[model samples]
Target: MNTIDLQVPHVIWWKDPALRNLYLAMPVLMLAATINGYDGSLLNGLQTMDSWQNYFGNPSGSRLGLFTAIMNLGGFSALPFAPYIADFFGRRIGTALGIMIMILGIILQVAPGVTSNMFIGGRFLVGFGSNISIGAAPLLIMELAYPQHRGKLTTLYNTLWYVGSIIAAWTVYGTIKYSGSVAWRVPVALQALMPFIQLIGVFFLPESPRWLCSKGRYTEAMAILVKYHANGNPDSDFVLAEFAEIQETLRLERESAKLGWAIFLKTPGNRRRLLLIVLTSFFSQCSGNGLVSYYLHDILSSVGITNTTDQSLFNGGLQIWSWLVSICFSVCLVDRLGRKTLFLIAGVGMLVTFSIWTGCSAAYSQTGNTGAGSAVLAMIFLFYGVAGFAWPGLTVGYSSEILPYGIRAKGLSLCLGITALSGVLNQYVNPIGLAHLAWKFYFVYIVILVIEVLCIWFLFVETKGPTLEEIGRLFDGHETQYVESEEDKA
Candidate 1:
């Protein structure tokens, strides 16, 4: 079999020199995902600490909900303005500034916070500062990655989210034995580690070449593209072709004046992009993942696993499993399997797992049956398996590639903004729902999963295998400028 004609699809690595620098920059962007994941679990573990509560006003009832909601609220509140910062200053500075605000937030949280309000304020600032970094990571990868590797690279950030979560889970778990504020304070203080690592890494990485080109820094853009995509070969035909494609696309975006906030609603294609993005983001949250992600300890308690140490260990093990699943799925399967197939598989599997999970939970709650509770525990692992392959992996990468460059960063901001709102609602209501609705609360997710499946079948499209610029054609007519050569796309 001739290699040229065979054209088999395989995940390539360790060959390209450009990938060396690209891989180096990836850790910087991935820190945002890791921190996002860490926040989900750190607070979970902190809440279990008696000393943490005694020091922080022992919040309960509505106040407890407010504690969690503030972070999501701060993030949503920041999104509208944050995108403007990203669009104006470029992704690198936007990320640094966001991380700076986060550093301030962490300082407040660790400063012997003797009041509930202090921790709340610190958590709020943490969300406010972190949103830009989270939103910008995907955009940076989308613009900088080669067409063949773009989907996997962008999705890789979500996998790192679990890496962060695992670290938080284990950190908080290990600190559980410490008396007084040290148990909680030590973990909260550790939050600074990821951001500082990201800041240093970002210090060495290049700005998005597309963003550079958008600002009319064509020479700089070409240099980055050459360095990262062409091994510094400026005269390579592939480099010249990609550069021309980017330039032409930017020209169209400029001439049309389709940019900033209004463009999302003003243009038909953008309106479609916005609708799909918001819908996907919303559906991802409602799929019952957050029920486990934020409150797995409570979820385990509902299933009769009451020992604190057991809960912590179970949570840590589950997080490690999740991180491993996501890393495998994103690295190997994403490119060949395509978004539509993976999403449908994930949606269906989640729907089934959740439906069975609700039954198990109801059985355990009503009859006090050990086997029923065991079944519920099993479903947690199953739901995570399906979910790790979808929301935190495939859907995230797809959303980043679906938007145009003119509004790409802002569009991701809007997408991340919508998730923050859904997340706030979910995080706030889940505890109440657990108390009042019990097993019935899961029915809400059951219905949501059905709708998520239907929506993915009808509204979602495959975004794999296209250059980010070429993906524009799916959303707008003007972006359909590339002429296809007869060479096998693989």
Candidate 2:
């Protein structure tokens, strides 16, 4: 597949002052992923802390399930309304509002003598606020990025999840050396740090130009495109072509939006898009990742590695490995390997590694073989490495880019909502399944992974070359006309 259109005018981003500044400001938006990553790792790490376990009276079974799953429940509650906030108020304001709610959640979680019920409430608020901010942040990044670099920038967005994960893992590890509530509370309190940085950064970000055009502010939208995308060249052919494409695409989408809620399923192409969206959302969370992501302590126990410090170290090392692998894939391989290919690699790699992991578990159980137990540990790291290639990076970016501007926010909302729903189901079921069945629980995911690989092979589409607006052509055969001047042809 082709890369972003080479015919489009190119600027060396770092050499241009405005473009360089815009790129510098992007990490603020990416902190949404960081917050999410930290939450997952923090909860997983807390389960290992003696202080946390004693403070909460050693929650287990349904009680422990509720603690971890409530955040996703909170996120699910916000999904229906998150799109309205992003679409109507604009991405910047929506982001700021979400961050404020997250800060409130941090306060409740770290408050003195917080009860189990109160802690659950705090997590719910974090999930709710996080959904709102996350739904809007990626939209801003994708819409604001220059056309030539759009795919890479958006793919790079979710990779920050591991950055947050790495921080949380090490923070929890370091604090465990302390002897009181302060150990766990410090990590919970620090969850606010990413959102605080985001709150400051959101103000300086330019609003989406496509959103501006949707609101009938074409002149302002065009000015932004010229300044940041074309380095203030009013006469640049690339800018003019890009502006015309956005104008035409939005015009067509407006007419289609007249169908109201039916627009997502009214056509065959729309049906295909919906199918991919659901599959991508579901596969992202349910592909055996929940086993490792949230319950590493239990998984380690099964394999006979029961030391607390060793478990924490393994968690920290996994996060670092994941972050580095995700960066390599996001920056160097995403476009070159193509979306469909990466999904396949991740699906098949996971199925193979996880199958081996399950077998190792069984072998360790039957023979008390240390080698079989060690293989289980190796499989855990390998399973996550496969997941890093696609799950953390492509799930959000691909879902958002496939839909047209008219329903982009709604489509993303659907993606996130299903993601939260699946997460809730997994978090609730995983611990109980592990508690009751132990090593046998591995078979369930082994079966699920087989189905995942099949679905990806038959259903996933390649979307490597087109600009965001032009991607509609792949799904709906939407045609656009960009009349270039003779000078631009040269």
Candidate 3:
């Protein structure tokens, strides 16, 4: 069997002036993702702060969990619509609209004397706004970036997301002693500023050339690509090559028939790819990272750390470690190990962690031994840091690469919508389960992880270094067909 060597295309870098331009774009993308992360985490960190309890009237257990979950519920609820808006209107437009919604959420969250209903409404709007960026950012970045650096660059979103969480943890930790409700409200409101900054920044930046080309705006696409390439001359060979590729992709797409919601379901290969991507997303959310990140303080407190300062320190430390570990994994192993290996490793790690946590909880409940329980909880936290960062980076990389260009946006949107719904379920259900059953919640995670492991082994194909065309062929089981066609052409 002849095998096509699957490796990432090499791009001109370092001496290449465009590398600097790409680096400059990183901070802006990071800032956008940071706000996204901060908004997601602010509520959880705030719940541990004394001012938050006072403002909300000292809610405990399930009620606090419910409050935390509400934001995710709102965000998830709005995600399904994000794809349509993004596909139809373009990613820049989608991102701007999302920012606007977030600003409304910030107002509701920070406004004095706002009713709970008002707060929920604001959060829902914020969620709606977040859906736009979350759905669009990867697509925008993937389309804008050179293929060689796309994985590393796109990882910026997740990295910045964690940075935002870190900021939230430390911010709440530092401000807990300050007077006024600003401790919590300030962080929530700070999120509103990011979108405005990003909105302005985006104006200076180029739109996705792919989107422009899809709309038959070749001149605009070529101009954007020239800027992206920064190769002095607009007619450079690289620029011409890229334009030709875009034209060919567009021609094939137009010839193949319009890809829409109905055809997505009716097509076998597309349906399979959609199911795989969505399931991967769903399991990633359900793997318990969301619960752990949002409820670390509660979980630590349950293990017997009563002092708020101590809990904050523990959470902050955990976030730092997780971020570091994730960065290491993403840099060294993401491309090397391929998607399947990472998911397999992550699933096994989750299963082990959840089992240990369950055992610790059972032992603590039976003997009332806080010390043993604490040790076990510490192990669980360590497991969380490692798996939390790895799975998401892998999942995002996998989802972005697996589909054909024609259906990439719609397929990703559908997958992300399922992910969003999973986020809602995770936000709502995990808290309820934790409140009623506490450590037994590990059993639920364990079950989910086992299923994830099986699904990956049986269903997912290796996509380590294949081109988009080759990867698409794998999904369609057309590799043999393509090989024979190449022979005929030869």
lDDT of each: 0.78, 0.86, 0.70
Lowest lDDT sum, 10 consecutive residues, model 3, at: 479-488
Q: Encode model 3's per-residue lDDT on 6-95: one tens digit a residue.
A: 343366666668656765765654555666467545766777777777777876666665676666676667655777777778877877
- Better-scoring candidate (lDDT), 1 or 3: 1
TM-score of each: 0.92, 0.94, 0.90
- Sort the predicted structures by TM-score, highest score first: 2, 1, 3
lDDT of 1 by residue, 1-490 (tens): 0111112133254577677657866878878877768888887787778887787666654576788778888889788777778767888888888899899998988885346777789889988888977767667777777766777788787788888889999999999999888999888889889999888888687888888888889899999888877777878777777787677667555643543477767666777788888887787676899888777767888888987788888889889988887777655688788888788888999999999999999899999999999999888898888877776875567777787665666777887788889888888888788778888999999998999899889988787776554466666654332222224223
**Whole-structure CA lDDT of model 3:** 0.70
Off by over 4 Å in 1: 1-13, 256-259, 477-490
Give the lDDT ranking, best first.
Answer: 2, 1, 3
Residue 289 in candidate 2 has what lDDT? 89
Q: Between candidates 2 and 3, which one is better according to TM-score?
A: 2
Q: Per model, how many backbone clashes are there?
A: 0, 0, 1
| Per-residue accuracy of model 2 over 27-127 as CA lDDT, tens digit each | 99999988878988898899999999999999988888899999989989988889889988889999988889889988999888799888999999999
Estimate candidate 1's alpha-carbon lDDT, on a 0 to 1 scale.
0.78
What residue pairs are clashing in model 2?
none
